[model samples]
Target chain A: MKGSGGARRAPRSTPRPRGRPPGRSSRDGVIAGRDALLAAAERAIARDGPRVTLDAIAAEAGVTKPILYRGVGDRDALVFALAERLTRRMTDQVAEQVARTEDPEDMLRRLVRGYLELAAAQRNLYLFVTAGGVGDKRLQQSLLLADGAAQQFVDGIAAFRSARGADPAVATVWSYGLVGSLHYVTLWWLREPSLELETVTEHITSLLWTGLRLEEPVD
Target chain B: MKGSGGARRAPRSTPRPRGRPPGRSSRDGVIAGRDALLAAAERAIARDGPRVTLDAIAAEAGVTKPILYRGVGDRDALVFALAERLTRRMTDQVAEQVARTEDPEDMLRRLVRGYLELAAAQRNLYLFVTAGGVGDKRLQQSLLLADGAAQQFVDGIAAFRSARGADPAVATVWSYGLVGSLHYVTLWWLREPSLELETVTEHITSLLWTGLRLEEPVD
Candidate 1:
C-alpha cells in the first residue's frame, strides 16, 4: 500500500543501449543487471528447489560471488528482492484478469486460479520462499512479503465491493484470511495435484463468494 | 487419521518412579527425563522465541549440551517434537470443545477462540514454530504439523456435517482451508490484538458456517 506495486517490477530485460559508458555503472545498467541475475536465480530455484545456495545462484548467473553480492546485497537482501519480484508478478497477473472482469464471482475465480497456477508453475521457488525457519529476521521477511501480497488482494477486494455498493470494510481481514487459505491449500495441493484445478478453485470461490454476500454486517 | 492423535501426548512429567534398578536407565526415567527437557525447551522458546539455542535449552533444563543432545537427537528433531506437542495440544483443546457443543456454529466459535487464546498464550513459541526458513526438511516438519492439525479439523467437520445429515465430502478441503486461515489470522492478530476476540471469531465462524451450509455440491 505504501508504494505502487506496479513500480516494483523491473522493466523487461532489455538489451543495453549501444554506446553506453564503458567504465561507468549507470543506474539503468545496474537495474538491468540485477534483473538478469534475479532471472538466473529464479531458474536455479526452479531447478534446485528452495535450498539452492548463493554459490549455486552465482554459478547459474555465470558470475562470481562478489558480483552476485554487489547485485543483490547479502542472502537476506536477495531473498527480499526475489520475494518482491514474485509478489509483483503475481499481482500483475491477477490485476490483468481483474481488469477484464466485472463479475465478482468471476473475479474471485480469476484471483484464486491465478494464485494456484502461479504457485504450481513455480513450485520450487514458492517452497523456497515459504519454507520454515527459526529467527526473527526470517519472520519479518516472510511477513513483509505476505503483507505485500495481502495488500494487493485488499485493494482488489475494496474495488470489487465498492463497485457494487457494498461496504468493503472487511477487506483487510478477509484478504489476509483468503491469502492464508490459498497459500496452505496450494502447498498441500502441489504435493499431490490429484484434485482438478477447476474443482479447487470453485470450492474456494464458493466460500469467498458466499461469505462476501452475507447480509450480516462485516464491520 | 492414521494414528490416534491422543497417543502423541507425553504423560505429565512425573517424579522418577520408585527405583527398580539403582545404576541403569529405566524406560519411565527416560520418558520423564525427556519430558522434563521438553518442558525446559518450551520455557526457553517462550522466553527467547523460536531461535533459542540448544545451550540455552540445556541450561534451562539444568543440564549440559551433551545431555540435551542425548535426549533429543538434534535441533531439527527437537523442533519436530515441539511441533507435534503443540499441534496435538491444540487439536485436543478443539476436540474437547467440539464434543460438548451440539451446534456446529458454536463448535466452530469455540475452536477458533481456543486456537487464538492458546496461540496468544504461547506467542513467541508459536511464532518460533512457524518461522520461515530454508530446506525441505524444515518444510516437511512444518507440513507434518499442519497436516496433523488439519486432519483434526477434517474429523470435526465430518462429524458435524454427518450429525446434521449433510454430506461431508468437502470436509478435507474445507478443513485445510480453514486451518490455514486460522493460522495466518492468528499470526496477524497476535501482532496487533486490537480487535475484540468475539468479533474476530464471529467473523471467521460466519465465513465457514455460511460456506459449509451451501446447498451446492463442492464439485
Candidate 2:
C-alpha cells in the first residue's frame, strides 16, 4: 500500500503460463524483484524490530537467502540503502514545506515543525534506521543528510546577506551548526512529546534569527 | 598510577593490625573501594574501547565478577556511573570557565570552546560514554547534561535580557537548542579535525550572538 513497488504485484499463487513466460523484461524483473525484497524486509523489520536476521527477511520476501543476498548486498548494505531512501523522503518533504514561507523565521519554524511531524509519522522507521549499529554507514548517511540541509541554508543565508557583504564562507559552519541542532533536537523532542512543538519551533527560529541577524560585535 | 582508591592500596601483603583498623570507617572503605573499581574500569575502557566487557573490567580492577558486581551494579550501571562522573567534570569545568566571563557573548563563546576542549582532551572517554547502547541511560545522561547546561544559559540569558522584559520561559528551549547544537558540532568537528577550532567556535558564537541580540522582529 505504501507503494512498495512489488508488494502489490499479483500474488505468488497465480500460476505461471506453460512454456511461454510473460514479457517482463530483465531490467523490470530486477527492479521488481528488489522492490519485493525490500518490502518483505520492511515487514520483517516492523514485526521483528531492527535486529531481524537476513534469513527471516528472506522468508518474508518469499525468496531464498541467495536471492535476498543478490538483491541487496548484505544486511548492512540493505539498511544503508533504506536509510538513503528514508532520508531522501524526509528531506524532500521538509524542503517542500520550508519553501512555503518567504520570511526566514517562518521558513525555519516550518522546517522544524515539518521535521517533527515526519518523525511522529514514521517513528518506528526512524528508530529502525537510527538504532545504533557497528558500521559507520549510518553516521555517513546522517552527515549526508545534514550536509544537504546545511547547503540549502547556506545558499539562503548568503543571498540574504549579500548586500551587507557578509562573508558567505561562514554559511558552511553555520548551516552545519543549525543542522546538528535540528538533528539532536529531533531525537530529544521525539522522546518528550509533552514538549510543545510550536514552542520549540519558535525558540529554534528565534535562536537562528538572533544568530543570523547582523549586529555590532559583542566583545 | 591512576588513583583507584582501595584497589591501588598495597596488595594484602601487609600484616593486619591486631586491633580494629585505626579509624577507617566502613563508609570510607566503601567509597574508596568504589573509586578503585571505577578507576580500573576506566583503564579497561581506555585500553579496550567502549565495548569492553564486565569480566575484563573486573580483571582490570583486580577483583572477581562478584566484587565488580557488588562494587558497581552491572555493565550498564557502571557505564552510567562513569557518565555521571565525566559529565559532572565537563559541566563543572564549563561552569567555572563561564563564570570567569561577565559578558554574555564571551560567556557563551567560552562555554562552547570549553566543551570542545574537553571532548578533544578525552576523545576515547567521550566515545566510551557515548558509545551507542541499548537502554536509554545514555540518553538520560545526555539529557542530564543538556538540562544542566540549559539551566546555566537560561539564568545568564534571563539576567542579560531582564531590562528588556524578555520572557525567560523560552530560555529552556533555547538552552536545549544550544546544547544540542554543541553536541552535534563536537561530533562533527571531531571527525573533521582538519578544520580549525577557532573558526568553528567563531562561527558558532557568531550564530548564537546574532540570535540572542535584540533586532527587528521577522514578520
Candidate 3:
C-alpha cells in the first residue's frame, strides 16, 4: 500500500447466499441477519477454500438456510461481499496511515509495512483479493484503486522534487518504481509469513533512497 | 534460469514425464503419446481457462481419454506437467537474455523486457505461476529459481556498486528494487495489451541511472 497524496476506496464485493428467501423481516432483523450470514461466510471461507458452500455458512451462522437467502445472495455474491469488506478495510488502513504522517516517503514506507502485516496476519483475505488479479475485473479494479492511492503518496514525493526543480521526468519514474518495488516486497511478505514486516520495509526504504547502477569490477 | 547458478539439471518440478523406462525408445509410444498430451495441455490451456479438464486435454490431443492416464497421473499431475513445461521455457528465455549482454545494466534491462514480453504473450502461464506465488512450496522454489536467475542480473548491479565501495548494503536493496519494479510493471501491462513495454523499461532505467530520489512535496 502506498499512501499516495490521494486515495479512494476500492470497489465493493458481495457473496450471495443460497436457499429460498426467509419470510419478511423488520429493518433490525435485516441488519442482524445479514451481519450474521456475512460473519459465517468469512469463517467458512477462512477454514476451507473460497469454495465453501452456503449450507456450511448458514449452519455456522445459526440461521436457517432461508434466513441466509433473505440476507445474502449466492456463494459468489457472498464471496464478493466479503471481498468488498476486506478491501475497504485495507483502503481505510492506508488512508489512516496518511493522516499519521505528512512526509511522503515515510508515509509510503509505513503503508507498505502496514499492509504487509495485514497480509501476513490475514492470509485468507490476502488470497481472496489477489487470487482474482487477472481473471476478475472487480478484483483488478479494486487493486487499481489501491494502486492509485499508493501513487498519490508517490505523487507527493514527485511534487517535492518538482518544487526543487529536479528533473520532473526522473521524479515520475522514481515514484512509479517505488510503488512497484513496494508491491513486490508486499507479495514476498504475504507468501513468507515468517519474515518480519519491519525488516522488509527497512530494506526496501534503504534501496529506494539509493541507486544500484554502478560499474563492474576490473580484474 | 540464472543457470541455476551452476546447479544444472536441477528439477524443481515433480511428476514430470520421465524420458524412458528400460527398453523404451526415445520416440516410444508412451513417450510420444505423453508429448502429444503435454502439447495439447498447452493448446487447451491457451484456448480455455486453467481448470480445463484432462478429458478435454486428451480429446484436444486427438487421443482417447484413457491414453492420458498412461502419461499424466491425476488432475494435479496434469497441472504439474503443464506448469513444468512453461517454467522451463520462461527460464530458458531469461538465461538467453542474461548471456547475450555484456553491460550489467543492459543485462538487467533485457531480462526485464524478456520477462514482460513473455508474461504478455503467455497469459495462462503468467496467471498460473502467479497463482502459485503463495502456499505452494514447489511452485515457489521453481519461481524463486526463476526470479533468482533474474535477480542475478540485478546482483551484477550490486557487484558493481560493491566494486565502487559505495554503500554495498544499499546496493543490494536497490538491485532488488529494480527487479521488483520491472516485475510489477509486467502485471500492469497485462490489462492493456498495448502498453508500451519499452517506455516502461526506459522510465525505470532512467530512474536507476540518474540517481534521483524525490522528496515530500508540501504545497
Candidate 4:
C-alpha cells in the first residue's frame, strides 16, 4: 500500500524515451541510448550494490547524469529499469540454454544450475533483484519475474514426471521444492562466498533426486 | 539476512510487574505489569505494522512511554523485544503443532499454512523481524529464530525424504526449494488477500508434491 504495486516499471536494458507520448518520432535513438544506459547501470550495480548511484551509472554509460536523469527520472527509476532488463535477460538466457534438451528433468536441472551459476557470477545483481529494494513498482515487477520462473519450472517438473509415469504428486513436490531451495542457496551463497557452487548444486540435486528421509522402495 | 520467517504468536494473557526483570525479586508488583505491557506491545505490532510508535505501544500497554522504556530500552529495542517474544511464541506453537504429527508431508503442509496465518495476523512484527534495519540486536535475534525454524522444517523434510530412499540430491533440492516457495507465499498472501489459506496450502503442496520437470523416471 505504501508504494506503487505494478504501475511503474523500473527502466531497464529495454528503454523508453523521456516522458514523450507514445509513437513520438525521435524514439529509436532514445530507446537505444536508454538501453545502453540501463546496461551500464546494471554493471555498476554489480560492482556495488543497490546503492549504485546516478553519477556512477552515468559514468559507466559514458553519458552525463542529466542525460541519464532525463531517460530514467531518478535513482530508483534506474534500478527498476536495470533489474527488469536483468531478469528478462537471465530468463531468456536460461530458456535458450535449455532449448535443445528434450528431457524435462534435464531441462529443469539445467535451469537450476544455470540460475545458480548466474547468481554466482553476478552476485550483486542477483542480490539486488532478489533482496534489494526499490519502489513498489520494482518490487512488483521483480515478484512477477520470480512467479513466472516458478510456474515454468513447476510445469516442466510435472510434465517430465507424468511422461515417465512417475507419481505426479512426487514430481510436483520435487520441482517446486527445488525452486524453493535454490532461492535460499542464492541467499546463503551471498553470505558465505567460499561455499562451493558445485557442492551447492550437488547437495540440492541430491535432495531432489533422493529426498529428506531415507525411505526405500516398497518392493 | 532480513525478516523473520512467517507466523504470529498470540499475545500472552498473563499479567506481571513493570520495570523488574524476571528473577530480580523485591519488585514483584511491577513485574506482572511490565509483562502485561510487553504483551500489549506485541499485540500492537501484530495489529499495527512495524512502524507503530512507542507511544502507541505504551498506550496499548495501558501505560506511559517512560514506564514502557524502563521495561525495555529505546524504540528499536522495544520492537526487537516484541519480535523476539513473538518469534519465541511462534516457535513453541509450531513445535507443538508439528510434534503431534509424524507424517512429513502432513507436517510440512500444516506448517506452511500455520506460519502464513501467523504472519498475516502480525504484519508489523513479521516485517520487523524479517526485513527490518540490521543495526538492532533484536533483528539479529529474530534471524536466529527464523534460521532455527527453517532448520527444523528442513530437517523434517530431509529426514522423511532420506528414509524413502529418495536421492540425496533430490532431498537437498526439495529442502531448499520448499523454503524458498514458502518465503514468497507469505508476501504473496499479503498482496492477494482473496487467496485462501487452504488454497495456498493446496497450491504449494501441489507444486512441491509434483516435483520439478517433465522427464523420465529415475528408476
Clash totals in order? 4, 5, 22, 87
Off by over 4 Å in 2: A1-28, A31-79, A134-141, A163-169, A212-219, B1-32, B135-139, B163-169, B212-219
lDDT of 3 by residue, B6-62 (tens): 646766777867653456454544544677778887788777654455677777887
TM-score for each prediction? 0.75, 0.75, 0.68, 0.66
Q: Candidate 4 DockQ category?
A: incorrect
- Winner on lDDT between 2 and 3 is 2
After superposing candidate 4 on the true structure, give the runs of residues whose Cα lies further than 4 Å from its correct spot: A1-32, A53-69, A74-76, A134-142, A159-180, A206-219, B1-86, B133-146, B157-176, B213-219
What tens-digit string does per-residue lDDT give for candidate 1 at A1-219? Answer: 122346666668668674434654656445338989999999998888787888999999977787898988877777778888888898888778866887656877888899999988888878777662246556556554458766665555555445444333355555567777777777777876778898888767765666322343222
Question: What is the alpha-carbon lDDT for the whole of candidate 1?
Answer: 0.71
Candidate 3 docking: what grade?
acceptable
Task: Kindly give the stretch of ten consecutive residues in candidate 1 chain B with the minimal lDDT sum.
Answer: B210-219
* Cα lDDT of model 4 by residue, A1-219, tens digit: 443448576857757565545454645445437777777878888786655566887888877777888877665566566567766777888888788697655665667678888877886776556544422333244454455565566565555455455443433333434454676656655555554666676665544443333343244
Q: What residue runs in model 1 are displaced by over 4 Å at the alpha carbon? A: A1-32, A132-134, A144-146, A150-169, A211-219, B1-28, B64-67, B98-100, B162-169, B211-219
lDDT of 1 by residue, B1-219 (tens): 222347666778778785344544555445338889988999998887767878999999987786788888677788888878899998898778777877656777788888888888888778766762356666556565557876666565555345434333355555667777787777767766778887778766665666322333222
Interface RMSD of each: 8.2, 5.7, 5.1, 5.8
CAPRI classification of candidate 1: incorrect
- Give the range of the ten consecutive residues with the poorest summed lDDT in model 4 chain A: A133-142
User: Share of real interface contacts recovered by each model?
Assistant: 0.40, 0.40, 0.37, 0.23
True contacts kept of 1: 0.40
What's the distance in Å from true for residue A9, model 1?
A: 43
Ranking by lDDT: 1, 2, 4, 3
Q: Candidate 2 chain B: minimum summed lDDT over ten consecutive residues — where?
A: B210-219
